[model samples]
Target: MTTNQAVSVAVADRRPLPHLLVFPFPAQGHLLPLLHLSTHLATRFAFSITVIITPKNLPLIQPFLSSSSQIHPLVLPLPPSSSLPSGAEHIRTLPDGTPSAALIHALSSLRPSILRWAKSQSNPPSALISDFFLGWCVNLAADLQISHVSFFSVSALLAAILHPLFLSLPPPSSTPVSVSPSLPSFPFPHLPSVFRRYVAGNPDWDFTRESFLSNSLSSAAIFDTFDFFDSHYLSHLRSSSYASGRLFAVGPIPPAVPESDNSNIFPYLDSCPPNSVVYICFGSQFTTEPALAAAISAGLESSGVRFVWAVGTAAPEEFNGKGKVVKGWVPQRAVLEHVAVAAFVTHCGWNSVLEGLVAGVLLLAWPMEADQFVNAKLLVEDAGVAVRICEGGPGKVPEAAELGRLIGEAVEEGSWPALRLKAAEMARKAKEAVAEGGSSFLAMEEMVKLLKQATTED
Candidate 1:
């Protein structure tokens, strides 16, 4: 038997075999989690895997593929891009971008081509795994007679939060928004208007309309998160979906643990002269108010701590200077792992939180949109590793003093030997959650079985 077969046989002795094709939502935030999950499955289950990246992400993914020679063989074909719309090109900041309607049309046009490519493969992927944002994958799988599974790349807690919101959406509203303005805001005050629209609009309907084609198709759903962080909510999804047996929790799909001395992952740790630097980053989807962004810069400068800031196009001029804003896609994983990063001033994205906790860094939580406020609550109130900042309004920005104080407090708290010890302990737990026989690893096994059954049974 081939080496791949040998590995598959060993893994499938307790279940069945599946070949997985993973397609992520076309953005960096969506792609990273799905790619991590793909990497994990290929290693643990010896599954034949194909990771589909838009031309834009080719560079980022290329490094990982090159870094590990073993993962090279499982790489399968990329779908032909010709049939997709010009607008479908995964360009950064596309001008005059089409709305969901046009995006849906473009995906529909590309569907037939994706199917033809699937058929052309030597061993067709047994199961198709894609981001819930792409909704068209459900129909494409139907056309190809393959099992399609939707994977949410956010935290299970976020998924659970969205799930109830999805269920509450009224049927076929004209604008997809049924909620009133007076609805109590989530405790996290800094949510942006764009994301507020997302929550206000029935995301369930959004999922159905944009991703699942109004729920006409039956596709299994999976989440990319671990039970340790969100066991209660994940358990709820599991119990609810037990009858359908269509949901799986397989996540915390970070890079594989190193042989020993994982300290290398946090390169900046040694450079710190005890609580010296503040790290700033907002989620990709969040828009930075130029005023607030400048105020934050002044705050950091005034506080007199070295800072590493990650900002996008919306960053103000004042923040762009010596030892301040790194601006434009800083190596987030690497920076968080740095020892100099005393505190994380973050938008409280789930991935960022996971990485910070892994690096034993304390947090200044600044959630903007969706369940981020809720996540901040869990961290600040439950975990005691972070502090939550209050917002001015729906789209209002905070003053420099507010941001500075939060950063200073986080750095101070993180510098305490006891707090650092606690962070280290949390880091250890995070590592265990992904190790062999850990919750995430076992969840992956269960998900693989579900995929294989879905593939073969059909």
Candidate 2:
């Protein structure tokens, strides 16, 4: 048997495993990271894992399923119709065609279903891991007397910044702002521009109430970031009020661990000479307009960059001649690790950024919403790993010239190779964190122990 197999068998033969119920926030970005973490926990700890997902997202969650019966997929039913806003189905489209407020509410509204699922499980979970934003899970854990911890499905840097804000946003005033349709800008300036836009439009005026909800609700906060990437952020978290000795940092959870080789899938994938292809993909959630997609396609063609763009809803048909579009999903980790993938053009999702860094690939940041813009900023400003597309006319799509010039400059820039080398170094540190004596492994051990103690006290 292979060394990994031997280790797996030994782990299985050990004492009874813990039962873990992992509930991710009901979105693609949230689901994928939590799934990766759940898979790791199941394989390494021999734990029985139940992943809670919304019914709408079950199809996307299904393909990742393993043959191992130890892992279970549980779908939380949609809530009562009355709880939903009017024309909720159409809410995927805002009045001006952006993502709608109703969609956000619908995602957050899954608390009742998740709580019911947890309480109703036949084999009660030994521990609970939930998304940090899902504050209601803490309440459910308390009500059910189950040990619970929050999962921040992003980087150590992002989570560290967010943790303090969770506490910081709570108001100091006598009167509270009402949660309403009109969202106001976030209290903090550090939030990404897109998040700023959303908050500006959709006021949770309920910030103080939500902050209290979080403090009272979660037993601990867990981050999906490794220790090496952002020591300062992690340290900040440990010392803050958001600090619960309950925080856990366990990650570098690439889509595939040890990478099961699939050379036949993309035969050209390995054959391409080293550092030739620019790997382009926004995370799974981003869906853009035909105009933007076409513009990006024209740019890739103009740049003469051999690329594999993992086509999602945002990928346009116009690029058929310019590059290969692997519809559905592509093994991102494998692509990044492939020698030919010299650079990554991305939406700057935390997981994507981490994986690219882990693979030591240079980056092209095209942030959409949420913390992505800030992540792009950090990569360019803090990490020195990427460059942004140049701004264009107000409504004009990126011209072939703009795309060509940036890609050419980035490729020829002597700094890119240096940055790639640095990114690889970061990746090495990430791997070290999960090694047997690594910081992430030890953190998990400590977290598991804390959960056992907390549950016992409860």
Candidate 3:
């Protein structure tokens, strides 16, 4: 038998394998990557996996559950809260696409429910792998006497940047703080919009800030970032948090695309020249303000580059030969992989960054909130694969002339080829990091060993 199979068989031989319980904060960017990672652990290690999901998010987990019986769902009804809009279990489904603060407040209510369920169980899970946003899971797992492995949906770079902030009392002020000698200090205002909004004495705000701080005390931490893309940051985080000594960098876990999928699937990409089309998408949670949207459309139109704009709303006037403007979703992974796609204009969300990196598509970054500004720094300054075209929220608009120039110049012959080449090199290392015997692969194996050890002691 092959090595992975042999490992799986040996793991399965230990009947009633150590159960892994997962809890994802309800957001598209956070949910999907953890699900993908959970599925990988199940298939490769033959471990039983149970996901803690709300009634509304159940549908999203169905396909992953259907394919693998090893993975199961533990549905928990979302307790009613005025803070959350009814039936809105995910940030993507929030009315008018609001950011996740309200949703985070609503999710904090589930802590008691989760605690009760675990306490009643005959076999409490060996480990509770939960989203970084739900840092209270560290305390929850402690209550159940299980390992709480904090799972960061953000880049390792962002997590490293947040470490100092988490330890600081009363959160960060307007001043900048140094995280690593290799990287620039981050001003508090640019850290995360939510952090600046914290009011120390308020219960909800204190709870939220406490949740962010609890990650440091986790039994272990895992980032959905592979070493190739965030090696320096990951190493810095490890050295800083060495007392925990169990940080894992095991991802950018390949997307769930079918292996047999083909380029002929997209006629526009199929027909376009190599390194020709520009791909534009901000994440689902972000909606461009109409004026900003109009400016972007005008810029794309003026640039004269072949492009694909998944604007979601406020579409540009289509010039038939120029490009296609989409109102909804596009298969991002497939689009990035296409030979015709030269560059991506993106929000620098961790998931989108990995997609662009793995495809070797250079970035034209428009980072808004959360850890995006820091992620933009990694791409623009540290890695040299992206150019920062714009920064700040939807209201922050740039001159159409400047925006068009940056977009046009991203693929222009000057420095574009070098950026693309470096991206390609990172992409190669990224794929290798997840393959057998790679840095990510070994880290995962070590995590599994720790998980199995947890159960044996039980």
Candidate 4:
């Protein structure tokens, strides 16, 4: 062959590697799953990855990305706003009583800077993957002529319940609507309460509504739930034309750290009996009220169970002797996997729920905000892997006796053997879904294929 012919052949074989830009909401629950997804894509498919995070949250996730050369972190500055305290870019850092309007404004201010950075990339990202709330990124991607995918850190069941198709239901005029009696087949019985609280009068209702609606227009929607756990909701989403046939279940994605690396993070686990200790945590964004925290502490003390509780801003002094009280960040995934951890007392945040399920630990659900109530219902009422501590609604706190009784019952050997068995089974399924040739693994493969195809077409 001539020199020109050889040069042409070389050029055809040297296709540029596709780069994906991931932007997660600046909260622990949202950031972890999207980070894991980015790591998985880079490790499994050799895709170039760029993760955009605010300056405040950079330190927390920087350690996780240090070893991965394939993934790069980009820091975006939060715009100047009097509404947010100085240096408080992350949702977790905002004051406990910060108005939702101010928080939403702070988040929305991120758009211009993100768009500017996207345009400045040396090799422009082939696609954009962002948290569902950052729906503006979808429009940004369209303008950049790249594909956009929305990542829902919540469960698929919650996504289905919040979809536009369901929100169109007529509201009751006088009384709060009881969806269970009207729609018996509905998967989430707790949604009516969520509707009454969030959709009706919450300050962030507009933001939530816009995010879910915008998600339908994305190239694909990704969920952090395994198929075995949410197959019914996934199937319903796929069959519905409103979902755009781009729904993908690619998770139950745990942190990407090695087992050995995480083992020593919590040394206290070694002293407790195997499957005897209860692990308690509310996700980063939720703060426990003083009264409720005291009640929970009293209950745990009375229950006679060994526990490690990670309460974000709640004073550790309150529960110093009753049980371990961890303030600030803890290695949650590491703690959950410890052999001594028998059950979880959680706020029912989807990430915590997924981690608990993956570890085969039974759950004592204490949902606090947003989709947590719906998630609690799914776990306790539908899946049988958890027991509800009390009726969940905004500002509803259980008595210490009730909390203690539930904790005691959840840990009793003879009280709910079937629930324990079911939890173990679900954990097995979660593991299977992410293994080679499993549903979640294949979903990742399919996503990479689609990304490559989009790049080729471009």
Candidate with maximal lDDT: 3
Measured by TM-score, how close is model 4 to the native structure?
A: 0.85
Better of 1 and 3 by lDDT: 3
**Runs with alpha carbons beyond 4 Å of true place in candidate 2:** 1-17, 63-65, 81-123, 163-190, 193-217, 256-265, 313-322, 390-396, 413-415, 454-458
* TM-score of candidate 3 on Cα atoms, chains taken together: 0.91
lDDT of 2: 0.63
Off by over 4 Å in 4: 1-15, 81-86, 96-105, 108-112, 165-208, 258-265, 313-322, 391-395
Which tens-of-lDDT digit does each residue in 358-411 have in candidate 4? 988888887776678778877987788998776555566678887887887766
When sorted by lDDT, best at the front, the candidate numbers are: 3, 4, 2, 1
Name model 1 segments beyond 4 Å from true: 1-18, 53-57, 64-88, 96-105, 170-219, 242-247, 256-271, 285-287, 313-322, 390-395, 413-425, 453-458
What is the lDDT of every predicted structure here? 0.60, 0.63, 0.79, 0.74
Any idea what lDDT model 3 has? Answer: 0.79
Q: Which 10 successive residues of model 1 have the least lDDT summed? A: 187-196
Residue 174 error, candidate 4, Å: 7.2
**lDDT tens per residue, model 2, 233-271:** 566656654536556777766453343443333676666
Provide the lDDT at 105 for model 3: 67
lDDT of 1 by residue, 1-458 (tens): 76467575756785433567776655667767776676666665566676665454566576456543334322223343333344354523334433333333343445655667777876677777777666567767777777778777666555444444444534333343323242223432333222334433543325444453322244677776666666666666566562154566665567643212422324434555666777778866656677776777777766666676767755543333424444455667767776677778877777788878887787777776655676676677656777666543355667778666766666665354555666677778777877888876777777777776765775
Residues 1-458 of candidate 3 have per-residue lDDT tens digits of 65357556665785565688999988888998898888877776766788999998998888789767678998988888765677889877777634455677678677788788777776668889999988878888887788889888887777776656555644565678665576578776677665656676766667777788788789889887887778887877777773186788888776542433332337877888888788989887777788888888888878888888876676754655788777666778889988889899999988899899889888899888867888888899989988888886646788988888888876676557778788889899888988889998888889888887887877
